[model samples]
Target: MEKLCPRFEKAMGLISTRWVGLILFDLLKGTKRFSEMEADLPISGRLLSDRLKMLEKEGIVKRNIYSEFPVRIEYSLSDKGNELEPVIKAIQFWADEHIPPEETDDTDEQRV
Candidate 1:
């Protein structure tokens, strides 16, 4: 048997994490603040923060901070992260074809 490519394995490891893929998928819409994502995703605040930090470190997500009375922060995909749109869309297409409606949370469908 042949071993998997390290790059591919690492990518899968990162994206396959719980809520990571969903986070990316959500970002496909556009830039969003932490509060926005927290409201949109079912993931906990701590986990979302952790994943955002990880993605930023990996250069897949970009974080912007605003200087103001109260600082504002927003998250957007980096060039590399935007490159994942196709893959995420493909997965969504596949899931739509194969997964039964009952298997997925109906609320998510409404949200999208």
Candidate 2:
């Protein structure tokens, strides 16, 4: 077996976490407020917050705070995050090729 490179391992460790990819992918569509992200992802608010912090630390996402009555905050992809577009697209392509479509009750279906 081949040994994994530490840098590669560390990079994977960050992105491989549950909900991280989905969060990144959602941000790819455009900037979104905290509430908007929560509504789109099925993850808990706490988890989403944690993941956003983590991604922010990694320079993959940007958080903007607006001074308003309630203090609005928006999240968007940083340049680094935008660089992951091809990577995400490749994963999406692979899934599309390998995974079978699920049988669901709703007409609107979503895939990661």
Candidate 3:
């Protein structure tokens, strides 16, 4: 069998990181503020912040800061990140088919 390429390995490393796939999946809905994501996902604010920073650095996510009294910040997928939509959808489909409800936690059901 052919060895996995470095690019594939790197991509897996990023997406397989805890919460990274979920973060990307959530952003697929639309751009969201940090607090919005915090509320949407079970992740803590600090860990979410860290993952956002990492994704931003990887060019998978974009961070926009609005110049306002409160300095609002929002996150959206970069073009590259948007390209993963089909992949994310496939995963969701697979889970729905193969992963029984009883095997998944309550939170997992609500996320879909």
Candidate 4:
């Protein structure tokens, strides 16, 4: 098929955003709560929540509730999500080696 199916579009759309790479990279580090993710990512609350929800729906992220008093929730990568690690790392490695400073508007905050 020439055109992308809605499911394909939806699935690819989940991790094909600006800050998604960073989000997934961080989630791979460990399970993190909503606030922790927000604090680590540069996107706004709405965008982060949207990304998290999309990933969860796509089976790339699994959310858990650990506390009720403060309503604590944590997000981690699912099995499928863990499967993306190598791809992400490969791409990141390529970018780290080739992409230079003054590139796109990605707020990596570190010089290669």
Candidate 5:
């Protein structure tokens, strides 16, 4: 096997975390409010918040706060995050081809 560069290892480490890929994939659809994302994904509010913060720190996600009656916050992919479109699609394609669908009746699987 070839040696892995530190930069590549760092990036892979960031993106490979649980829920990160799914989060990015959802954001690709368009900007989403915090509640909306929470509804769409089965992730806990705390975990989601932490992941969003991490992504923001990495410059992969942008969080926008709107001064409204209730204070609306939305999340969208940054340019760097958008660049992962091909990578996300490739993973989706590979999973579709190689992974068999689960026969579980749990509705959680439908979320992300």
Candidate 6:
């Protein structure tokens, strides 16, 4: 783990950032509006906007703004971004089995 050089470390760092994981997680579902992301994620507007732009620049997300009405915009995963779905699912499975029920707030509820 520590053996990873700074370059890889920085690349991986973006994915592991506080809100980026959840941000990407939700975006993986489908195209989402800025407001939709803001509501679902516990991130500040500026930070979320910044991160989305970063992801777009990284070629992980595609942002499209519509020309109709008040103007609509949405974010969706690119081909490369879709590749991370399996990794996210694996992480979820690992957490479910390894993380203690008491450690998470939803443990009291029935799980799928």
lDDT of each: 0.91, 0.89, 0.92, 0.82, 0.89, 0.83
C-alpha TM-scores of all predictions: 0.92, 0.89, 0.93, 0.80, 0.89, 0.82
Candidate 5 lDDT over residue span 2-112, tens digit each: 999999999899989988988998999999999898988878999999999999999999999999988988999999999999999998898777777774334654433
Number of the top TM-score candidate: 3
Q: Model 5 RMSD to the real structure?
A: 2.0
Off by over 4 Å in 1: 105-112
lDDT of 4 by residue, 10-110 (tens): 75676677778888898889899899988887778998898888788879999998768888899999999999899888878998888875676655542
Model 2 worst lDDT run, 10 consecutive residues: 103-112
- Residue 22 lDDT in model 6? 84
TM-score sort, best first = 3, 1, 5, 2, 6, 4
lDDT of 3 at 45: 98
Alpha-carbon deviation at 55 in model 1, angstroms: 0.5
Tens-digit lDDT track of model 6 for 1-112: 4587987898688788766778778987899999998887777899999999889999989999899999999999999898988887888799888989777664332232
Query: What tens digits encode model 2's per-residue C-alpha lDDT throughout 1-112?
Result: 9999999999888889888998999999999999999988878899999999999999999999999989999999999999999999999898778777764322342366
Query: Which is superior by TM-score, 4 or 6?
Result: 6
User: Any idea what lDDT model 3 has?
Assistant: 0.92
* Per-residue lDDT of 4 in model 1: 100
**lDDT for each residue of candidate 1 in 44-102, tens digit (9 for 90 to 100):** 89999999999999999999999976999999999999999999999889988898888
lDDT of 6: 0.83
User: Which residue pairs collide in model 3, if any?
Assistant: none
